[model samples]
Target: MALTGAASAPPRLAPGGVVTRADALLAALRAAAPDPARLPRDAGALLGERAALAGLRRNGRIAAGGRARLLCAADGWIAVQLARPDDVALLPAWLEVDPARFEGDPWPALAAAVRDRAAVPLVARARWMGLPAAAAGGGSAEGGAPGMDAKPPLAEARRAGDAPPSAAEARPADGAPPRVEAPPALRVTQAGTPRRRHAGPWRVLDLSSLWAGPLATHLLAGLGARVAKVESTARPDGARRGPAAFFDLLQAGKESVALDFRAPAGREQLRRLVAWADLVVESARPRALAQLGLDAEALLAEHPGLSWLSITGYGRPEPGGGWVAFGDDAAVAGGLVARDDDGAPLFCGDAIADPLAGLHAAWAALGALRAGGGRLLDVSLAGVAAEAAAGGVDPRACVVADAGGARVLCAGRSARVAEPRARRPAGRARDLGADTTALLREARA
Candidate 1:
C-alpha cells in the first residue's frame, strides 16, 4: 500500500473500479487466524447493499435526489441535507423562503440562496443552525483552485526554502498528527485470564443502528451466530423509517426486539438479553447506553467472553467526541470526498463510511472473538472512512453532460463513484419488532 501525501507529494489515487478495503482487513484478520479466507468478503459482496435492498440498483447507478444533491455556492460548493421533516422545516430560515409555500424539490430554493455566497461561511451557518451540510474541498480550509496533477504547497514546501521536508520534518504545526487516544477507539482489559471457552453456535445482542454495527452483526449472523437486534421503543432505529426494503437490506435474518429501558421491566429484559449474548454490538457514543444503566464495563465484568463493539463518529473525545455524524459527513471529515479540478469536493458513494466501517467492525469483532472476547472495540466512523479512502481504491470517472457545445464545470465533470463487483447474498429485511415475541421468549427461557 502506498503512503499518500508523502513529503512534497500528492496522494496517489488509482483509476476507479471496485471500492474495496477488504485486502487490508483480510490481512489483518489473517494475522489473528490460521485461515482467514473463509470469511466472506461482504465488503465486496455487499457493495450496493443499500441500493440493492431499495431496488435502486436494478437499473444501474443512481445518485441521491431531493435535498440530498450537491449544490453550488458563489465561492465553491456544498452538500445540504433537507431530507428530514425538521430539516425541510428549517429551509425557510436558511433560504428566507416560506416553508409552507415550498413544496416539491427544495434544492432550487436553497440553491438560489447559495448562488452568490462562499461555501465555508454558508456551511458554517448551516452547522450553527443545526443543518447537515459540508463544504467541498480537498480537506482544506483555505479553498483555492487545485493545482492540476501537482502537490499542494503543504506537501511541496520543506521549511522556508530548499527541498520538501523529509517525512519526519513534514509534521504539521500541531506536532505529529494526533494518534486519537482521547476517548479511545478500542480498549482492552484482562478479566482474569483468557478463558478457554469452546465455540459452538453463538448468540449476539445487536444494540446498533444504521449501517456499521448492524452490518457487523449481520455478517456474524451469516457466520452461524443467532443475532437478536434490540432497539429502544422511545427512539427506534431510524433505518426503519427509510425505504422498507432498504432497511431490511442490512438487517434481515436477525431477531428484532424493541423495549423502553425507562421501564423497570424493560431494563430487566435488557439485562437478561445482554446476559444471553456471546457478543454485543452498538454504535452509541461514549457513555450513551451507560447513561441508561447498560454500562459496558460492568456487563463485560460479568461476562468476560462478551465482546462489546462501540462505534462512533470521531472517537469518544473532543472535536467529534460527543458530536453526531452520519456516513457522508464523517467520510468528508476523513478526506474521502472526491476533489474537483479546483479541489472542491464531491460526495463519493452511498454514505461510503457506513459499509467500510461495517466491514472493518465485523472483522475486528471476529478477530477479538478468536483472541478471547473480553474487550470494547471502538469503531470510529471517521477512522474507518479514512482507512477506506487511504486504500487508494477510489476510481472516479468524469460525469459528462451534453450541453450546448459539450461544456463542463470546475471539476470539468461530476464524480462517478465505483462499487465493488460482488453478488449480494439472499435475504429479506424484517419489519420492526417482527421477531419480538420469539426473541423475548428465548431471552426469558
Candidate 2:
C-alpha cells in the first residue's frame, strides 16, 4: 500500500492468504456484480467468470491501457471499454491484495494463513489478471487498473515488453521520487555496487522445481549471486512451460541447467554444486531430499557452511499431530481461504502462498548464510497459510463476493481451523472466548 524507495514490493498476504491484488480485484468485482451474493461456490470458478464478464463488457476496446479500467472499479464498478471482442473474452485470474505483507514488514498473521492453506492444492487455472493503466486517462503505460493498479510507479518503470529499466534509469534524477512500473517479477540487486565487491564465500545451488524453490534462487540471482538452477529432465519445473508472462517473468536473469540427479553423473554434479554452494533450496517434501541423497545433515557434513533450504507443502513433523497435506494454491483456499457460510471459497486468485514462502526462504537462507551456520529451513506452505489468516480459518470473518453470484461469510472475527466453534454442538461451547460467551449463552437459553 505504501512505497518508500525506488523498488516497492508488491502486497503479500500471509503464506496461504490472498495476495493484496487478488483481494482488491475480487472485492471490486463483487461490489460491481448485479447481485454481489450470486458468485460461484469455488473461488477459481467465480474469478474465471468475472474475468469473462469484464471482457464481454469491454467488447474489443481492449488496449494496452484498458487494464486500468478494471482497477477503477475498486472505487465502484464503472463501464470499461474493450478494443475487441477477443480482448473482452480474456478473463483476468490475478487478484490484487494488500501490498504491505509483501513489501513492508511481514505480518505474522497473514503468513500463518498461508501455511494452513497449503494442505489443499489448486491448479494454476489462470494467468495473472493484470490491470494496466490507460494512457489516455492520465494513467501510465504500466499494467495497473486506474486508481488501484498493483504498483503504478513500478508500472511506469519498464520500457516495453515487461523489461525493467536500466539500473541508472531506474533512479529518478532531480531528487524526484523514482518512478517504477508494476512491482518487478525479478528484483536483482547485488549486496554492493559493482565497484564495491561484496564480501563472502558465495555460491548458491538451486535444486528446486515449481515457482517456490526456483523463485527463491531467482531472487538471489538478481542480488548478484550466481545461481545454478538444477532441474532433472524427468522432474522439470512446471513453470518451464507455464503462461508466457509467468515463464518469462519467473525465469528472467538466471541461467538454466538440467541434470537428472537419479543418474550417477547427476548425483556427482549435484554433489559438486553442493560442495561449491553456500546455499541450496529444494521444494520436495520432507525426507524426499534424502531420496536424492541430499540430506541436510549429510550436506552439512560435506559443506560445513551450506544453507539447505527445504520447502514443503506442510510443516516438518512436530510433537503435536499437526502434519497436514497441502497442494500449491488450491489447498490454501480450501483450508484457510475466506469463504461464505453458503460454502463458497474466496480464492486469492494468485500463486501467492507458495511464492511468498519462497521469498521468505530466500531471506532465511541469506540470514543463515550471514550467520555462518549451515542452516536447514523447512518452509511449510500450510504453516504459511495459517499465518496468513492470523492462525485461524473463520468463515464468518469477511464476506467474499465471487463471479458465480455468491457471497460467503466466515463466522466470527477470528476462527481457527484447529478449533472451529461453528461446528460445535448446539448449546455447547468449544473455544468460545468472552465475546462469544454471551451469544452462546443467549442461544442456549
Task: Residues 76-116, candidate 1: write the lDDT tens digits.
Answer: 55667655688777666655556764677666676776666
* Estimated TM-score for each candidate: 0.67, 0.44
**In model 2, what lDDT does residue 230 have?**
66
lDDT of each: 0.56, 0.38
Candidate that scores best on TM-score: 1
User: lDDT per residue, candidate 2, 244-307, as tens digits?
Assistant: 3444444554545566667987676666666666777776654556667776656665556566
* Native-structure RMSD, model 1: 10.8
Which ten residues in a row are the worst by lDDT in model 1? Answer: 1-10
Q: How many backbone clashes does candidate 1 have?
A: 6
Give the range of the ten consecutive residues with the poorest summed lDDT in model 2: 118-127
